[model samples]
Target: MSPLARKRLGRVALNAAGVAVFLFAVFPVYWMVATAFKPNDQIFTTSFIPFPDPPSMDHVSRVFTQGVAGNSIWRYLLNSTIVALSAVVIGAVFALLAATAVARFRFRFRTSFLILLLIVQMVPAEALLIPLFTMVKRLGLYDQLLGLIVINVGLTLPFSVWMLRTFVAAVPKELEEASWIDGAGRFTTFWRVLFPLVAPGLVATSIFSFITTWNEFVFALTLIGDQGKYTMPVALQFFVGQRSTDWGGIMAASTLMTIPVLIFFLLVQRRMVSGLVAGAVKG
Candidate 1:
């Protein structure tokens, strides 16, 4: 084949692969959304229905009206928002400071500190549940939303520090030095020069932390005992029963649970894009 023809064929093949991957990732989400609007009769039907013939809001209505676990759905949403946001805020602060230290400063045991962060990341969160639970109880934080926030901050911190370190290191140290020469204090140099540049990595890590904490099932379930304090993930579990499951309700609740994450991404997407471009230019 001619070289141009081969190149064209390869481009076409890559486009097709991209489309396939997109569909593979999106189909399950589409199915869940479709099921949320489907009537009970259609949901259990033998044959496939690509779209609900006549969409129903019965499941969504039930979820809002009936609520979950003796509390309004809003309560659970609020709890989740509180915990996830708190964790993200706290985690981001610590991660940024730690990342800056590791990237900028020459200190003793720096290599060992970085290695320890990696080691913590490698440890499965599930394995630490027993010990964490015991510690939280001992500290009188068990069953409180604050405890969950603290746990999430701890859980996400090491990875955030590790990830943000790259962003910090990517920034030209010369910029900070220039700011200092211009009479900018250490705090001013960080806030004005470094923070804006590293914002992308911070947002990325915050999103990961938020999502991780928001959808976290094991810790939220184990740490919190009060129904009033249950987050969305835990609230969703109330839909399951021994004999049968409320699949429609589960789908509906899940759909609701996803909105905050989508909104968060939408709000930060522009900033994230700008941050990436800024980092590239600065680097």
Candidate 2:
């Protein structure tokens, strides 16, 4: 083939690969939504049906009306939201402070502290489950939403601190110094100058913490004994039975569970880009 033809062929190949990857990632979500609307007959059918024949709202209606485990589905959703939001807010505050400290202040064993954060992130969460559970129990935080928030904060804090540290370090210290010379106090400089520069990283960290806590199941299940206190993930288990699984109900619930995440992402996603632009102009 001529050189131009070869280049065209490679471009086509790259486009094909991109499409394939997109399909791979999105197909399950599509299937789940489709299945949620499918009639029981279509769902049970062995044939591949990409779309629901007649999109039925039976499963969704049933979930709303019947609920799960004798508790309203809204309760589970509320619990999840509460835990996730609380963790995000608390974690973001501490992570930004810690990141700022690590980047700006030189303390004894500061390097060691950063390393320890990385080490904590490296260890699997399951490995720390037992110890965390014990500590939560001793502190009388177990079975409460506060405990879940604290656990999630601890689990996600290391990553946030470690990630935000880079953002903090990337910011020029001269800005703060200039503010200080201009009669700005330490808090003023931090809030007015430093915080804006670091906002993108903070938003990113908050998104991570929210998604991690929102989807967490093992800790939610093990820590909370009351069915009424179940988060969305734990509540999802109610759709499964000893001999059969409620595929439709599960899909509907899952679809419902996915919306808040989409909304949250949509809400912050613009902030992520805008903050970067603002920081660039400010710098």
Candidate 3:
């Protein structure tokens, strides 16, 4: 084969590999959605069907009507939303401030502080459950949504700070200097000049925090004592029983749980892409 032909063949192989990887990643999600709409009889049958022959809304309807664990399905969704949103908002603010400090200011123990943040991120959350639980209980935040929000913020904060510091540092110091020369106050410079550039990174971090908090299971399960206060992740467990699992209901609820994440990604995906690219170029 000529060199040009071999290069073309290699490109074709790469494209084929990319398509295969995409399909492998997407198949499970497609299956879940398909199964959610399948009738119980169809779902359990030996024959594999790519899509439901005649789709049914029975499972989805059951999830809404019958609810989960003595509370409406909406309640769990609301709890998850509240916790995720709260964590994202709180975590982002603190992360931004800390990032700003570390990125812009020189201080003693700065390296140590960054290292500590990394150490915290490296520590598995499961290992801290006992200490966190005791601390939450002592603070009288046990079994409350606030406790879960606080825990999520703490869990996500270190990574948020670490990720955001890079973005902050990537922002050209010349821009801030120019703003200062123009007599812009510190707050004005930050709000007007720095914020727009950092917004993408902030959005990316918020998405991460939101998704992490939304899908968080262990802390929600351990911290919350009230069944009614359970988030969607914990509530999904209601579909499982010792005798037989409600596969249909499980799939339906799982599908519902994924909608917010998809919506969030769609809303900010462009900014996220740009943010990542800009960070890479700047770094």
Candidate 4:
């Protein structure tokens, strides 16, 4: 093979691999949406039906009108949204501060602290569930959205701190020195200089926190006692019975659960791109 021919062949192979990976990731999403609209016969037939013959909204209609577990589906959505957004906001603040300290300062046991965060992350959330439940109860936050928010923040904070530390450290100390020479105080220096550069990392971490909290099922299920307090993941349980499961309803609910995440990613992706360009221009 000539050099140019080999190069072209490699490019073609790379493109084909990219397309295959894309389909692998996206096929499940497409199947879920299709199943949501499929009629019972099409969904349950022995042979495969790739597409719904005539799309039906029976599941969607029933979800909206009948509600779940005697509460509106919208209520559960609102609960999940509240918990996810709150967790993201609270987690970002603490993570930013912690990352700054870790990346910027020298302190006793600093290395140990970083290692401890990793150790905490490696410990399964399920193993900590009972202890966390006890603590939440002691703190009088059980069965509240606040409890879920606090749990999520704790769960995501280690990763956020670790990820953002690199972004923070990538920023040069000379920038802060220059700001100090110009009479900018510590808070002003951070607000005017460091924070803008770190914004991209913050947005990236926020997306992770939001999606994790939104899709979290075990904590949400075990922490809250009230039916009305359930998040969307927990609310989906109502569609299942001992004898039979409501596949259409489950798929419909899952599709609905996926939309907010998609929209959030689209929004965050634009901001991340813009932030990167702005940081580059500033540099």
Candidate 5:
């Protein structure tokens, strides 16, 4: 084959591979959405039926109105929101301070501390569940959103700190030096000059913490046992019963649960590009 023809064929092959990977990644999400919208009878009737025939709102209405296995989904959603937001708030502050300290100072065990954070991230969360649950119970925090928040904040903090450290370290030291020359205090220099540069990183970290905590299930399930205290994921289990499963309601609930994360991503989408550029250029 001619070189030009081979190059064109290679381009087509690459495009096809890209499309295949995209579809593979997206298929599950599409199926979930499709299943949620499908009527009960239509679920297993045909794989090709991508949407509900009559396009009913019954499942959605049921999710809002009916208490699945005696659990209030809306209340659980509120619990999830409270836990996730609180975790993100507390995690971000701790991460910011820790990141700043690590980035600016040459302290003892600094390298070890960074390495420890990476190691912790490598450990599977499931392995720590039992121990964490026992600790939470001993502390009288079991079944409370406060306990969940505390655990999530701790879990997400290390990575957040590491990420922010990179972003902060990337900022020019000369900028801070110039600020000090102009008589800016340490706090002033950090807040005025460094904070703006790391703003993107902070936002990125917040999003990560929020999503991780929001979707977290194992910890939530083990820690919070009461139906009233359940987060969205735990509450979702109510849809499955020994006798039968409420496919429609499950889908509707799943769909509803996904909206907040989607909205959060959409809101931050504009900042994401700017944040990446800022962090990259400064670093």
Candidate 6:
């Protein structure tokens, strides 16, 4: 084939591959939503049905009214929101400060600290689950939202710090120095000038922390035993029975569980984009 024809063929192949991957990802979400609208009788038999010919709100209504696994879906959603938002807020404060320090100050073990953070993240949560369980139990924190928040913070903090550190270091230190020279305190410079500049870093890190905590299952299951205190991920387990799984209810619950996260991302998505652009421009 001619060189021009070969390039055209390659481009066509690439586009085809991209579409295939998109479909692979999107099909599952489409299937989930489709299944959520399905009636119980139709769910197992017609799992691949393209669209509900006569969609029923029965599953969603039950999810809202009757709940599943012993607690209302909304209650689990509320618990998830409280835990996730709290984790995000706490993690952001630490990440921002830690990122600033790692980016700005050169000190002994600076590289080691960054590496250590990565190492901690590498350790499997399952591996530490037993020890963590015992520790929480001993501290009288087991089954408490406070305990979950602490663990989530520890799990998410290191990665968020490293991510924010990159954004922080990308910023020009001269701007900070100028503020300092003009009689601004370190806190003032960071809060007044630097914080606004790094809003994207904060948004990105906060989203990471929120999603991590919100979707976390194993830890929530291990730590919290009470149905009233269950996060959405753990609470979704209630849809299963020994004889038969409540597939429709599970799908409905999972679908509802995603709403808060979707809303949160939509709200902060603009800031995240702006933060990236600001970082690139300032860098």
Clashing pairs in 1: none
- lDDT assessment of candidate 5: 0.86
Task: Count clashing residue pairs per candidate.
Answer: 0, 0, 0, 0, 0, 0
| lDDT tens per residue, model 3, 1-283 | 9999999999999999999999999999999899999999999889988898799999999888888788878889999999999999999999999999999999999999989987998899999999999999999999899999989999999988887887899899999999999999999999999989999888888997798899899999999989989999999998898899888888999999999899988887775565445457657
As a TM-score, model 6 comes out at 0.88
* Residue-by-residue lDDT tens digits, candidate 2, 168-236: 998999999999999999999999999999997788768867988999988998999888899999999
When summed lDDT is taken over every stretch of 10 residues in candidate 4, the lowest stretch is: 270-279
Model 1 lDDT, full chain set: 0.90
Steric clash pairs (candidate 4): none
Q: Rank candidates by lDDT, best first.
A: 3, 1, 2, 4, 5, 6
| Model 5 lDDT at residue 82 | 96
Q: TM-score for all predictions?
A: 0.86, 0.88, 0.88, 0.85, 0.87, 0.88
Top of the candidates by lDDT: 3
For residue 186, what is the lDDT in candidate 1? 95
Model 2: lDDT to the true structure: 0.88
Q: Let me know the TM-score candidate 4 reaches against the reference structure.
A: 0.85
Model 5 segments beyond 4 Å from truth?
1-10, 44-47, 262-283
Q: What are the per-residue Cα lDDT tens digits for candidate 6 across 227-264?
A: 89999899888889889988888888888877767787
Model 4 lDDT at residue 71:
81
Residue 212 error, candidate 2, Å: 1.0
Give the whole-model CA lDDT for all candidates, comma-separated. 0.90, 0.88, 0.90, 0.88, 0.86, 0.85
